[model samples]
Target chain A: MWRGVTGTARMCCLESLTYSACTRTIWSWRSTIREFVTLNVGRFKMPAKEVSS
Target chain B: MNRKQTSISTCFSYERSLEDLFPLISSAGFTHVSLGAKEPHSSYLSVSRRGDLLQLLHDANLRMDSIHGIRLDLPGALSSLTATAEAAAFLDVPVIVVHASSFDFDPSEFDERLEVVLNTCEALAPVAEDTGVRFALENVLPGPATELVRSALERLPSEHFGFCYDSSHDQIGGPKPFTLLDVLGTRLLALHLSDRIRDHVDHVVPGEGFIDWEKLCEEIRHSAYAGPVSLEVLMNFSGFKDQVEFLRQACRQAERLYPLVFGENAAGL
Candidate 1:
């Protein structure tokens, strides 16, 4: 019973570490994509009203 | 180029006092004047006597369309600009034209220097707005300086900030005159129309130089700008009469070309 409890605790720790790392990688990619889109698309897309005004 | 829509800069007669220049412009058949804020005529600095100046202009039958801000002491640029704005407000002038940078500016420190200028303009933008005047930055040499001004305008993004298209400077500078007009578009608030020969800023008669006036008119017609096409020539061709005739003829040509460029009965005019 003691051995089983220790094994389960080690598995949970590994899973938690992998989950955190994957989340961070996904967020980093998301931010990069957001920046690229904003720079490329947003630059030419200044509101027409702004130009007229 | 209706005489009613035309203006002449007093910088052409910078040696004369405003008191003297007003009568000359009025006598020349020009109803509007672009007041110069330079020495001998640094009248814009006399903030307390603004009323007297206005009365003098009124007596001469000349209206102030704009104020040409002078560049003297580099450190005093902001103060001069603020005073000019005040003068513009008091006189009910709609625009104030300013030089892009000082004559003594170091090209090596262009960006850094431009940043400082931009900061000054940003600080003064609110004052301009409060006084119901627009600050139009005129293009000076090295060509790329205008791009710097455009960047500053973009960053500030105020209705009080715009571009003053100086034809002679644009011709001397790298960009084609019409291209600068196109780039400026609706941001164009004032004009310093003069002609140039090659790199020389001759400020000669309009059609007598390298600038293609027809193309300029076309570009202006396409743009939303509808303001005075003010002449800023420094030299009189022969005498004051000849110079006035030359400007009057140029205005006629511009008026004739307007319909050709923008089609008949364009509403914006």
Candidate 2:
């Protein structure tokens, strides 16, 4: 029973690590995509458009 | 010789009319102001109202040294240019600082877009010259906009065309900010002094952010620019007094560092 408990604990720890790694990767990509959009496409609209509209 | 005068942008408090803000600026010991060509306060669309604004400035004992030109894309750009030039002429302002471009074109369309911008500048250059005003194209970031302006300056070769270097934009604009002063040299007509923290374009007070004002002062002193360092800081009413004092101190620090960085003769001390 002790051995089984130790095995389950190890599995839970690995799952937690994987979850955090995935979260970090997603956040990194989110920031990159935001910057890419801003630099490559966001500035096309004129400031006047926002003012006039 | 007297030290180069310091000016502040009206963008600091756009909600406040010239009558309300000019006194505050004068009280802060700023004799010169750069009028922002936007809504509610100093609108280029309401160029006819410039007479009243001029009266307010005159009453406040402040001078409108320059204008931050309106940003409009083609079809409307030429008309806006005319209005801005007219306003500048009416106010007797010498420089009308404008953005090179506001659009984000694809890398594939870079050359074509640049050609369009250059042609537009070419068409507007003569208008600026006729009105006794200089078109100082301000640098923006995340692309080759500055280089494009440089090319436009080369192709046009007009005395009316010049550059307005923005420190905050340059901080995020890939290249080192001071290097731009070296590149533009005598073509530099005006400055938009602000600070940025890392990739964020904060426009915070000079020393509060990551900008090295000492080094930038040295670069400006070494360069051919002798104009007022105008602050294009973001608006914050509660801390307005602190911001004014901060800019005053920054200008004083630049003045003190000028001789140290460039020596007596170069600094004209």
Candidate 3:
């Protein structure tokens, strides 16, 4: 996914990328990046089957 | 030189009754307060209400430092602004904090609005002189308000007109942060010291958010404002439901800030 995106958005699109180097470079924007990830992933979670039946 | 005084805006008491605000601040250890256009203080905006206003302040054992005049009621703010000066005089408040325009205004109408503000203030010059109250136009946001403030300061006389620097607004609303202090160093008569967060969450306690208090303290210390560190802080979003506790926290932060700005003496010599 990061192969296409660029800049902070590219850096923000990863799952295993809480690296110190990334944090150091993007210190001012890491919180927003984290929130973006949290919201995007949280929005697509699937419900358990038969839970309401 | 003396220790810088501390005062909080009455916006924190919007939920409480008008009469209770004075005593509340006094009990919370705040000796002075800046009146706001909050619901509690809405009806008390006149010279006719002077007697009641005085009795309230007198009974509370607190004095008014300033009044946060109309921030957005436009097209007819002349009367309110004039009455605010009258009220300030009656209360012996030295300054009246005002906005350049409403919080949300059209960018296209900048000049028109600016002209309106200037004309209204031009009309208030006589009232300001008569009441001996200085109208301090506060910096609201970075764009037009900033420009308006600069123009107003340049055009108006420093005797009856001045500038107010709000810390949160300076931090968030800017072409660049904290440049107004350097740009216009004169007539800094009032302050709205508060903190700000990224999502436009402002008026939080001084230390609760991301404002650099030490830097701000140093800035003001080097400036010409030798008056109260008047905090235009609010409590609705500060997580403190108890107003007294909120005031205490603000006062404690202010105590720490005073030394940073003025050293151990509480005033720069």
Best by DockQ: 2
What would the per-residue lDDT of candidate 1 be over residues A1-53, giving only the tens digit for each residue? 99999999999999999999999999999999989998899566654310000
lDDT of 1 by residue, B1-269 (tens): 43445567776666667777677667766667887646346456676678888898889887777887764126877877787788788888999887766533455866886778777887787888789898887766634566666766677665878888777767664336467777786788887776665444356656666777778877876776667556776564412245456556655544454464456665323
Clashing pairs in 2: none
Q: Candidate 2's residue-wise lDDT over A1-53, tens digit each? A: 99999999999999999999999999999999989888978566444211100
Residue B140 in candidate 2 has what lDDT?
71
Clashing pairs for predicted structure model 1, backbone only: none
Any runs in candidate 1 off by more than 4 Å, and if so which? A1-53, B1-3, B37-39, B71-73, B103-107, B173-177, B236-269
DockQ of predicted candidate 3: 0.01
Kindly state the fnat score of candidate 1.
0.00
For every prediction, compared with the true complex, DockQ reads 0.01, 0.03, 0.01
Candidate 3 per-residue lDDT over residues A1-53, each given as its tens digit? 56556665766755336675676778758877888888899566664221000
CA-lDDT, candidates in order: 0.68, 0.69, 0.73
Ranking by DockQ: 2, 3, 1
lDDT of 2 by residue, B104-191 (tens): 4456765876777777777787787789888887777636665666766767664888888788777773336577778786787777
CA lDDT, candidate 3, residue B76: 63
Write candidate 3's Cα lDDT for B59-103 as tens digits.
Answer: 987778888777523766888778778878878988988887765
Native-interface RMSD of candidate 2 = 9.0
Q: What lDDT does candidate 3 reach at residue B210? A: 82
lDDT of 2 at B2: 48
